[model samples]
Target: MTTMTTRTVEYPADGLTMVGHLAIPAGVGRRPAVLLGPEGPGLNDVQRRRADALAELGYVALAFDINGGRWFSDPEEMMAYIMPLLDDTERMRGIGYAALDVLRAEPRTDPDRIAAIGYGTGGAIALELGRDGVDLRAIGTINAVTTGRPGEAANIRCPVWAGVGSEDPIMPPAQREAFAAEMQAAGVDWRLVVYGGAEHAFHHPNVDHAVRPGVSHHPLHAERAWRDVVGLLAECLPVTE
Candidate 1:
């Protein structure tokens, strides 16, 4: 197994001292990096472990916090905080940019070659960064295909790949259609994968969550999605040894 280094760092954003988990591969040379956004309830071990997995693949990865490093077990409480931010695009942008800055500032990160992958609310933030005109190499999202302000989609320069469960209530057929329309209208190189018989958060493993009904763990699709995202990074942000 390749050696890896992991650490926790704090940076200010959204009027809070946001904490983020950073993972870097053992090689001394700088590498292509990826920013990971956690689900709405907030950052957790799952997201941090994802950073480690990326590190194993020779990519610098940072899983940034959205709620000041707080993880919520209550669905209602999570929405109470997230719904208002949804209305304030600028605030969301501020949060995303702050974390991006941290990732770029890392010595091991190849600032110019970076990608963003997010789940749930984190996915929305990644999309927002794309919409805000960040030069991302690739964008991967799941269960968070929320569209942004009209006309802003044109700013996205990277190829976007989004996946969602067919029966996801949060990201229903209408929402997916709208997201597709926005990507098409913006002339983005985008693709949406609808996993059959899977519900929201299907890529997530079997863990305790407040809202589990609409979400599930589909091992087959989970592995498939991981491979697709890996292929994306290889194509867009190859890490040369």
Candidate 2:
């Protein structure tokens, strides 16, 4: 196995000091890169580990932050910060772009060939960036397929793949239809995967504690989701040696 390097990245966003985790693939020169986002709480070790895993696949990955360095173990605390940001498209774009800049600035990243991915609130932020007209190679989200403002989704120039658990009440059938409609109306190349028998945030392995109803970890589906996202990246943003 090839070795990879990891480091801490601190920056400012949302009037707070943000800490991001960065992973660079070994012996790289202008490799495709990805900007990863976290769930509502904030960036955590899980995201950091995901970034490292992506690096192992020969891509630079930066797990960006939301809400500075704080991870809200309390649902109310998370909602207090995330709920308002959801209503502000530009704020989300600003947050997403900050990490994009960091990723692009990396020496090993190919700026023209990049992707954005996130989970939960992080996924929403990635979608917001696409709506804001960023030229990303691809966009992938797990349980974050929130529809953008009508007509704004046309700005998304890359293929988008979204996955959600079939039983995810937070993003139930109605919401899925709405998201598909938004993508259809915009003429985007989009795909959605509904994992059967899974619940919300199924991609998160450590979400064993059901802080909120209808959210739990599905180990089998989580593995499948990872393979699906990796396939998406391979198809949309193929990195060369």
* lDDT (C-alpha, whole model) for all candidates: 0.91, 0.91
How would you encode candidate 1's per-residue C-alpha lDDT over 1-241 as one tens digit per residue?
4599999989999999998999999889999999999888888898899899999999999999999978887778988999888778898889999999999999999999999999988899999999999999999998888999999999999999999989888899999999999999999999999988778888878642356667778889988888888888898888897
- Kindly provide the TM-score of model 1 when superposed on the true structure, using C-alpha atoms: 0.96
**TM-score attained by model 2:** 0.97
lDDT of 1 at 92: 83
Q: Which residues of candidate 1, in runs, are more than 4 Å off?
A: 207-212
Query: After best superposition, candidate 1 residue 67: deviation in angstroms?
Result: 0.6
Using lDDT as the measure, which candidate wins? 2
Q: What is the C-alpha RMSD of each candidate to the true structure, in Å?
A: 1.5, 1.2
Which candidate number has the best TM-score? Answer: 2
Relative to the unseen true structure, what is the C-alpha lDDT of residue 51 in candidate 2, on a scale of 0 to 100?
98
List clashing residue pairs in candidate 2.
none
